[model samples]
Target chain A: MKKLISTPYLLWMAVFIIVPLIMVAYFAVTTADGAFTFDNLAAVSQYANIFVRSIYLAAIATVICLVIAYPLVMILARIDVSFQSTVLMIVMLPMWMNFLLRTYAWMTLLGNNGLINMLFGLFGLGPFRMLNTQGAVVLGMVYNYLPFMILPLYNVIVKIDKSVIDAAHDLGCNNAGTFVKVILPLSVPGVMSGITMVFVPAISTFIISRMLGGGSNLLIGDLIEMQFLGNSYNPNLGAAISLVLMVIILLIMTLLNQFDDDEDRVLM
Target chain B: MKKCLSKLYLALVMLFLYAPIFVLIVFSFNTTKSRSVMSGFTFDWYVKLFHNELILSSLWNTIIVAVIASLGATILGAAAAVGISGMKRLPKTIVMQGTNIPIMNPEIVTGVSLMLLFVFFMARMNLEMGFVTLIIAHITFDVPYVILNVIPRFRQMDPNLYEAAQDLGCNGVSAFFKVVLPEIMPGIISGFLMSFTFSLDDFVVSYFTSGTTQTLPITIYSMTRRKVSPEINALSTIIFLVVVAVLVINNVIERRNLRKRGVVR
Candidate 1:
């Protein structure tokens, strides 16, 4: 009786989720005529710089987000309890807004003749090349994904037992020592989750790089997108690239999970 | 002094977050087409937004897809949760892991994989990609969220409630309606709303699968590639307002519920 209702969805997953992944793997290993080949996988190595750049930028963004969000979230956790929800709502409001629009907002702010440049010009500074650079792409990622990092960190930190911190203090630890020992260790799960959430989307984003990084900073996502929808038109190559991306993500998630004792919380 | 410094830091961060949104909202009222230069105040773009057929149609498409896909996911997810609740450890773990795939995988990968699936099958099946394919893609991504939401409610539910209802002379189905349904309604509602929001905001999967069917995000994507226009600013302002309204109302309702429960904090 319990099995009856779930059967439809289980079948749905088999067709949609499981089979489609198998299809990606299948296409990754085969050529256009359905003949088996390892060439597609080998072809992906040509874009080694792109993969590295994507990882580098994404890692930088994730680290920046962690740095910015950690202090802010800790402060937020210490705020007056009655006002916390309203403050959290404000923090999350941008996240609720359209992703494209948020990124587009930055485009306007960072353009050659943008608001920031206008402000700088008033102070006798020449316009800096802010947009269409790797820095802009990282900034976009940090801006868009900061809330993701904050929310998870806030969840874990705010829930940390107050007595733990107090006990550390009572046992001759200074404020900094207590934070480094008790608070930081307890927030590892949050940090792990926060890193994963920000890093995954940041690494895979094509739009941020396109809109902000312009033509120069092509990431792995752009490469895959080009093969499928853009001018490149090579589905097999796209599949191979995607397969590699999945493996990279799986590997990172595995590495992160090593720090997190709670297996269920690990996205993998 | 330290408290003052922390508050100042928080204020600066909040400013960074809100400054762009403020710029967009302010620019939406500008008479000129420029994103940066606000020449004069006007309602021209907001007026133009209403008359833009493409934008309106895409908005309509977004709504239709969000509503249908969310509803489908809610039903499918709720039922699956109920079913999975009674499963053995192995199958339950397998199903749960399968459900996590869409949530864990990058949107690009999910979009590519699904596009491949549809493209491969559609060639032989002779089915064109459009609204149906778009909804299927949305539902596929949305169901896992619903299951994640509903399963917790199932775990929280007292197992004896159904038996109690049956003992009081209700049939199994009727007992579910009377007892179990109300218990899990909050989870289902949250799941549906979450799915709806995700579908409404989704661009990547829809981009790959929609073919000719343009949703609002897809439309926004194309628009962003063009020169700056106040119409987009106007549209974003409206979207921002709608988000604010929804969140505020949800907050109020939650507060009211807490009050009713005599747990006012």
Candidate 2:
């Protein structure tokens, strides 16, 4: 029976994960004409514009999430424990709901006859084009991923000892100084995790761009999706792009993991 | 002064977090076609939503997919967790990290990769895309979550309990069934719930993999694209309520357990 149960797990890992990864690596190296070529790697250079846009958008979204989530985390950290849990629940509730539905809700709010434009109309302002703009894309990204940013930052912030803050106060560190020099440094792990969580997924998300940015904003995720389901049928090129994205994600995660270790040492 | 400002910030952030959902729920009862006005409330949309066969069938499809995929993922993940617990350290670390890849990787990457794999298989082997392919993709991603949940519980288990069960003359299989299974049941339940929620809410993977069948999310996407209809709003409201209820129930159970253990008053 032990063997029976264990064998299925071994088989699952082999067939689903390891084999597919091996196939992806093989596809990344091979050309469409079935010849072993470095052309796929070279092809990545030609798609430089897509890669840049992906990084740029992800960076912008990460900054936005950090800016918004930091204050919220600070507030949660200062609050009583019961209120902290309630706030955390409120933050997480949307995440638990269908992500697609949340995106759809944003679409509704941004559309021509949507709520925001309607408010503008009430102010005698004409129908403003807010839906397909870069702002809309950023807004959608922040909305969908804010919880991911908040939870981690909150975790680290809550773990910070109050005595440290009191000691900082005794040493004449004012509120702003203490926050910048002490709290921020201590919460580096949460910030790093927040950035990684938001940046990695935000860069690869095509749904927000497709729904909110209205086909104009072409993210790397959309590019990959296009290769499969859209007009482009080049799985080789798609694999190449995926490999590049995976590498970039690994680089970011490694940076964040180092900070995670630092945070652990601080806690200890 | 700083405290007041921080409190104000908290309120604003909470409002931003909730405003979209609040608007969606309220608009479900709007009488007008437009979403702007506070029109007279009506249950017409909810009535129409229930009568829509397409939406109903899609909901059913989503439920079926989530149930089957979550069940499969839970079984596989639990088995993998138990197996890994007994393995050597290096191999266990590698396998554990590998399992977490699905969770850490972007949904789009996973979706595109699986889509490409299916297309390649279809062209090469003359296979078709349908329920089986969707289930395979879901299980592939969801098993990692289950394994992550269950493995910690297994690690935390007292090894002596298993030895005592063995000493009581029970066979290994019977001992594991009676002892280990009971110990890790909560972890299994949590993992199952996590997988179920993930499978139900997944859009990108399902969108890429589903050839004919439309899940609830896909249907919602299609409807939202056509027009901002109250039917979609009603559907969202229903889903929101159900999710909140499930979470509340889970929280209550957890709190009760904590209280029983004297960890909380």
Candidate 3:
């Protein structure tokens, strides 16, 4: 009887979710001629630079987001609930504007003759190139993804029982000590979720790198886009790169999940 | 000193967050086209944006697709959440893990894989890619989000409420409508809104699957690839205002609901 209700959803998932993943795997292993080959999977070694760059840039962005978000979220958690909602709304409202437009806005600001450069000129630092660099890409990532980090951390931190901290304080722990031993450990799941949320999009982001980093600093996402689009038009290789990316992300998430679980056990 | 530092830090973060958006909005009203300089304010670009046929259609397309997709995902997801809530532990876990696949997977993989599915499937069926495929893909991704939103509400619900309704002589269907629906309404609403937000903001998945079909994001993307005409800035401003209005309305409703719940409790 329950199955009857879920049939629509299950069938939809089968056709869209399960089948699409299977298609990626299939394309990853096969040649364009319909013949099975390991060549597609093996091609990951060819684009090793792109893969490494993606991971490196994404990691830096994720770390930066975490650093920025943790303190902000701590303050947010301490603030009044109604105030927190307003702040959250402020953070999230920009997301309502099209993401591409948001990213594009950065381009105009960072353009050589754009807003930032013009400001720099007023400060006697004329025409410092900011656009089309690795830093710019990381900046774009951090700018776009900081909210994803903040929201989860805020949620988890707010849910931490006040008494948990009180207990640590009553045990003669200082504020820093209480935070380190009680609060930080309790917010591990949020940290993990934040990491996943930031890193996944950062690594796979094409538009940010393309717009801000320029085409010169291509990432795995651009490679995949190229394969499907006119540049290379090799779905097999794209699928292979995608397959490798999926596995790498899955492995990272698994490790993070284990770490979070371990933290939960220690907290208990 | 600590409070001052905290405020300073938050101010810097807010500056970082709002700077680009401020730039976007500022340029929208600039009399000159150059992003570098500010001239006397004019609403010319905004007027141009209104007349832009491509932007208008894509805006229409984006809204309709978001509404239909979120509504569909909510219904399907709410049902799935209910169904899974009833299942034994093993099956429930398996189903949940399956649902999480799309939610957790990197979006590039999801986009490319779905594009692959459509390309192959459409060729076999001799169907062209357009709104149907676009909407289908959006719904596919949106369902997982909706399901994720609703499932927690399902778990938190008191099972005895349904039984109590039954004991009060309400039939199963009526009992579900009266007891279960009200309890899970917040989740369903939030799920709907989240799905709407995602569908509206989506670029990658839409980019891959939208062959000649332009949603608002796709349109903005193409526009941004160029020098980014002020029309885009104008469009962004309009879209921003609309979303802010919607969010304000949502917030008011949510607070009212909370107050009502508080009184009842």
What TM-score, to 2 decimals, does candidate 2 have? 0.92
Q: What lDDT, from 0 to 1, does candidate 1 have?
A: 0.92
User: Candidate 1's residue-wise lDDT over B1-265, tens digit each?
Assistant: 9899999999999999999989989999988877668899999998889999999999999999999999999999999999998899998999999999998899999999999999999989988789999999999999999999888898999999999999999998999899998999999999999999999999999998998999999999999999888788889899999999999999999888978889644
Q: Which ranking of candidates, highest DockQ first?
A: 1, 3, 2
Clashing pairs in 1: none
Candidate 1 C-alpha lDDT tens digits along A1-268: 7679998899889998999899999999999999999999999999999999999999999999999999999999999988898899999999999899999999999998888998899999969999999999999999999998999899988989999899999999999999999999888888998998999999999999999999999999999999999998999999999999999999988988887786435221
What does candidate 2's lDDT look like per residue over B104-215, in tens digits? Answer: 7888777777776787778788877778889998999999888878877887899899889999998898999999999988889989988998898988889888888889
Candidate 2 on A1-268: residue-level lDDT in tens?
5545656877877776777766777788998777897788788888788788778878898998999999888878778875667677877898887776788788878878888999889899969888888788888899999888887888888889999999999999999999988998888878887887888889999888888988877888888877777798788888888888899889877866865666342111
Question: What's the distance in Å from true for residue A156, model 3?
Answer: 1.2
TM per prediction: 0.98, 0.92, 0.96
Candidate ranking under TM-score, highest first, comes to: 1, 3, 2
Name the TM-score of chain A in model 1: 0.97
Cα deviation at A14, candidate 3, in Å, is 1.0
Clashing residue pairs, backbone N/CA/C < 3 A, model 3: none
